[model samples]
Target: MCTLTCIAISLIIAATIYYLRFVRTKPKLDIPSRDRVVVVSGAAGGFGTAICRDLLSRFNARVIGLDISKEVMEKVYSEELKQYGSERLSFIECNICKLEECEKASERIAQILKEWKTDRVFALVNNAGVSNSPKCTERMGIVEYPEDELLDVFGSNLFGHVRMTRLLYPLMKDGQDGHNGAIINVASVAGLLALGFFGFYTSSKFAMVGFTDSLRREMKSLGKKGLRVTCIEPGFSKTAILNLKPQADTEFGRIGVIREKKSAAILRNAQPPKVIGDAICEQIFSSNNLPHLIIDYWYMRLVYLFLYYTGLDL
Candidate 1:
């Protein structure tokens, strides 16, 4: 009876602790975002377009979208220009991977800020990335992967964003100019997990995850009290990331795509990319000082948690 009583009491304490730590809801904050300048890279397709729309329509902020695709830019511009007009929404066509292109893009942004009479940037969303499709070859590991392709992935996913942050650092000012600044990096769940056949993509995201953490620490250490750096990791979503075409029809022949029952079930129920936009909008200005948000399905959390703890091969 004594042992039973102690076990029950311990269970109660553990439950209470868990509830307070992870189950309790944190308060959400809404910063004054109206008319402020927000920059979103990869702002043409996938979650980029949706994030820009949310910032423009919901926050009523002046948004400058940076995208590499001119064709997509023309289409999005035509649609959004009618609603928000040039003062609130615009797009710049520039490849983020190229330093000169990013420089040109920043110059244009400077002109916009000068015209708008705003010297500070409110936010920078580094959401652009690329993935290599698994070719039907015998490349079994990172050693078999082409070195150039690995560099390309890092160029867009990590280094390009780094360049943007460095150039825009002066403009952000981290509330020194009275408006709080933010940097949101959009990474995939693959960043957290080592998914097979995504060596290049996963490596880049892992680097991004580490960079986001270090950047946050750097901001605090530098006494930038108003600067908040965060990273968002999304799970399987119906986005352009899935546009990689495997040459063969069979499940194994397709290289990275697994078509077994469990895997198919996960893919069949992939969430739309727009949810990512809504999630980021909801959390962008929250005062909880959140380091990262794992926007994924319910079971995904369990799967990753299990895999994370047990060192399971599956």
Candidate 2:
């Protein structure tokens, strides 16, 4: 009990410092709404939907939402976005994993920009990726993982976003005269700290975190420029990606499968997905955004701190 208390106190102190450094309020983006053009991938998911609507409501800006499946896109998003006319919102059928597909998307988006008479996209939100939804995909140990399964996970989680960034980040670079351009990638806490029973998914997120950081540093060569790369690490949120119904009739005796269920139970206190969406929008439009924006509770942040200082394997 005493040890736990000490840990809690230390965490509280760390969180206080972190809040002061990264969470303090700042001035809103001082740009005209007419100049804002945001492209969001995986826009049909729970958080994706919230991000699209929030951007439209907050800025009345042009939003392009993309999902791989045409059917899912049509089913999840309504044709009529009230208040803001349908003109402010558009949905695209895109598969970011395919290079050719991403190229085609760029051409289409370029046409839209020409129509909007805007020179560039203000931000690109890379929120599409697979998680522990199927359950079976995560049952393997590191060596037990099949080559094909690993590629599929990385294809959606890492390569897809890389493709999107390569093709679309140029738009952000050439954005309006004074506007800041942002590339926000939604990674998971699983990436920040390795968790058991999530081999492929965790590694993919780890790679994403690394990629975002490297990109940020490389872009810094522009010398005090406004273009930024940010990686958002979120814990359990009320999203179908992680909270999907576990498949039934499976053998519960499997060790990894049981462990996965236990992890899900411990994550019963997931915050709503809106918090994440709002955070992304706020960070984008804020005068400055952190290199890493974490969306979990204080204790989770504490764990991250502990790992950082001690270098202890969790």
Candidate 3:
């Protein structure tokens, strides 16, 4: 018993040291100048709003929010415009699933940058996404999942970002106006672990991770060393995606699935949206060539790392 206790204490110390040295270490990269701009999709949502506000308030960055809802965009615009002038905060209505719309939005963003007297886009945050609902609520399992909803999930979660990246890459290229840029893709832990009931959502995130990895390698090989691509895989948070409403009490609710219940429990200790926002900001400003950032509790982080290293699928 004494030996076991000593071993446990040693493991604890080792974990603490690892966390301090690696997990908590800050990047040494310089922050982008005030003249550069950052674009965030789904800017009305919890994570998007937090990131935009952080970049604008902390870094003094010009932030442009893109969302499908004109009303929500107007609301955010009004609130943020009051705190930070139009020069610091702007909004563009974009349905990312549509390639043409993405192209048009890209054009408008280019104009905005030109007007601001800056010819570069510092980063693009692909944060827009939809989550799996109750078993029969349209976006559930793969076998019975509505074909249209499935398509929409793939479109918004994966292809939409693809379209946005394709449209914005020219502006973000290494030599595009002498600016270095980053692409921040918000994936999920579900992307790494195949949750039982969240087949559609998991599948989409998996594809997102794959795409980010491929893009990062391609950029390096193409001599665009100034352009960095990163994937953020966050554990469950208290976001709108949780949808813990009256429906959540039903038998077919999110809790109906053991996997979701476990996720929800972990989210009881989940980090807030601001944590994710701050991490993204750090990634952008840091000099490290980090390809993946996992934001979660210590235990979740350990589990993910162990599973990843062991090639074990959860």
Q: Whose TM-score is greatest here?
A: 2
Across 205-293, the per-residue lDDT of candidate 1 in tens digits comes to 98999999899888867664647888888888888776654423434335544533336667677888878887776656555536777
Which 10 successive residues of model 1 have the least lDDT summed? 133-142
In order of appearance, the predictions have TM-scores of 0.85, 0.86, 0.84
Return the top candidate by lDDT.
Answer: 3
Q: If the candidates were sorted by their TM-score against the true structure, best first, what order would they fall in?
A: 2, 1, 3
RMSD from true fold, candidate 1: 4.9
Please, what is the whole-model Cα lDDT of each candidate in the order they appear? 0.75, 0.75, 0.76
Instruction: Write down the lDDT that model 3 would get.
Output: 0.76
Compared with the true structure, model 3 gives a TM-score of: 0.84
Full candidate order by lDDT, most accurate first? 3, 2, 1
Tell me the tens digit of each residue's lDDT in model 3 across 1-314.
99667656656664664486456775665755465688999899778988988888777788989998868877766767887877787788998978888988999999988888877788888999887432335333456556675777788889999998888887777544444588999999888877666647889999999999998888777664547888999887768776643333434444435555555556576678898888887777665637877787777776765555445555
> Which residue pairs in candidate 3 collide?
none
